[model samples]
Target: AQPQEGEIIGGKEVVPHSRPYMAYLKIKVKDRSGSKPSSCGGFLIRPDAVLSAAHCVLKVTVILGAHNINVQEWSQQRIHVTDWVIHPNYSSASLQNDIALLKLRSRARINENVTFISIPRSNEHVRVGTRCRVAGWGDTSVYGSTTDVMMEVDLKVQNETLCQQEFHDYQRLSMICVGDQNSGKSTYEGDSGGPLVCNKKAHGIVSYGPSGRLLPLVFTRVSYFVPWIRQQLRRFALQELPASPSSQ
Candidate 1:
């Protein structure tokens, strides 16, 4: 069966301010030669840090705290990415380790609308049939345009073995497959880098999907990268630490 190519297949509109940690990332090309204004979804991990798929870390500007793509509200926060770090092992070919951390130029104000989301522990496991929620501002259906407002859908975790049957190269250890084989509800192109939240914790990062097939969507397992995330944070903190007087 031909998979639908829409961003968010069969999703409902997310209520404004409901998912505050959800981030709408805008990619502004330098010369405007490529795609005019490409966009992706992500989630706030810290006041100045955002977690998203490595593919979303293009050389462009990123905007956070956005609700409606068409309207700018006080709750919205825009930050030019000072820098970003993609997983060292990230593969553009196979999309392995498709995770990245975006550093903001300045700390984002934490208010009613913008906050960070908790990540699952390294040992946490999301079993098959577990219901999770994913929200993004991507195409509502195949061959449809991206939506102005954010949308969300509920999806269930699928068994890794079953997912492997579908994708020949699926890495079960570091990736998660989500969707209902029967319902065909799945994420699409513009929804890349969005978080898959289960039990109020981010368990996966939307990675890729079968291009024209709505079978199941793939995500980078957040639990597998939890240690890496802590390492990055600790490394950054050390780099920012002041030099000791004795050393000076």
Candidate 2:
């Protein structure tokens, strides 16, 4: 489907791609009118939780499903967020430590179509040149706005040495680099907080701009933040609802 206004699309053509891995994240920020729906791409990590870039949750509302921007089909199972937790160290100017967790008011109904992606275990390594997939409802073209239909792009992990040199002063252990300068495929502004997956498991969260003279897509490595993530999960556990029979 072609992306409509305030939607993310990959150019004009509607390419055939998989949609299940991409979660439609609808966020309603404070003071946002219902008509101006703010959305980003995210992936499910736990039964009732989602992992996205910290910046995406700035005063937000979340919606799962609904890949087409023009339609609200996925609204049927909306997960209203009761809490948003941004990384304690996140800084807006540098966009560092840009990670966050969303706590849903209730558990999501899981089925074949709705499931969670595994988070990378601590110390899990995805080396340079590893082929990975990134999906999001972000703007396809630079000048064009965001798209409604979720888009996918194939990427190769870049060597850390090269990435550091390219990003200059801002790169760190928390981030992973991916994308191709010649491939004509890349991530845009609204694509922040999306996932970069491999083997159906989430390896990173889209975080920073790409490297070199031109910005490339940088993802925050999930494994590197496992300790911090565990702490957040533990903190949220205090308010978690008992697992439903279906979840067990």
Candidate 3:
């Protein structure tokens, strides 16, 4: 968890191409020495926009229509985004406001193998205990090798009060606490920047968790940022925004 690489360790393989909106990311994070390649997951929200975690944004290449990322499957569409926007108030220290939107250089050609997921309406809310699932490719056990095949795990939304006690910085209005308290069987966090889908809508975004081990996961509550998302989407649709921000 120490801000080192984080991905899921184990999950059930999802049917290939079943989650058409999935976006596999290849990222290079530059440091004083150089950079290192990292991976994360995301989801298509529009023909030209993808939603992901702010911390995961960088020199990113997105692969859509991917099931087996290891193989250049026929359905894949690799793309570089035209723009990236990390929430203005994003914080590395606290991991607050950890959401971002990316505009594609080219509109995605939607098909059975590629499409977009629905974002919640402004101010809409998901209830505690609501069942949801997160999907990605790299969920595995510690010391387990990363798997290229997409995988997913089912989870349930938890009470905010518990999260408040566990994470001193927890913000109920902006973040969601997820995992199963009974089984602790669903602390899936590898799909950072991936969607927390509930009833077919993306209600949350994979965000930071405890640095080293699996605990209940936290997600950026997408409902709280619907206004901002819509504003950015309008700009992306109108082509009126200034130059995109970098690795921001």
lDDT of 3 by residue, 93-168 (tens): 8999999999989989999999999989877889998999899865565454467788787888999987897898
Give the alpha-carbon lDDT of every model.
Answer: 0.82, 0.69, 0.83
Name the best candidate (by lDDT): 3
Sorted on TM-score, highest at the top, how do the candidates line up?
Answer: 1, 3, 2
TM-score of each: 0.91, 0.82, 0.89
Which predicted model would earn the best TM-score?
1
Q: Measured by C-alpha RMSD in angstroms, how accurate is candidate 3? A: 5.0
Per-residue lDDT tens digits for candidate 1, residues 1-248, read 44343436776777888898988888854564756677889999988788999988886555566778789777788888777889999999889999998877788889888899999989688999999999998877776656788888899999898779877779988999899875747777788999999999999999987767766888999999998888776665555564532211
Off by over 4 Å in 2: 1-21, 29-36, 74-76, 210-215, 241-248
Q: Which stretches of candidate 1 lie over 4 Å from their true place?
A: 1-7, 29-35, 244-248
Q: Which digits, one per residue and each the tens of the lDDT, describe model 2 over residues 1-248? A: 22233323222322433444456676655564454557677777776678898878855555555556567564335767888788899887777788888887777776655667888888687888888877777776656565656677777787776667666645657888776655556667667778888777789898767432224567888888888877777666755544422222
Cα lDDT for residue 208, candidate 3: 69
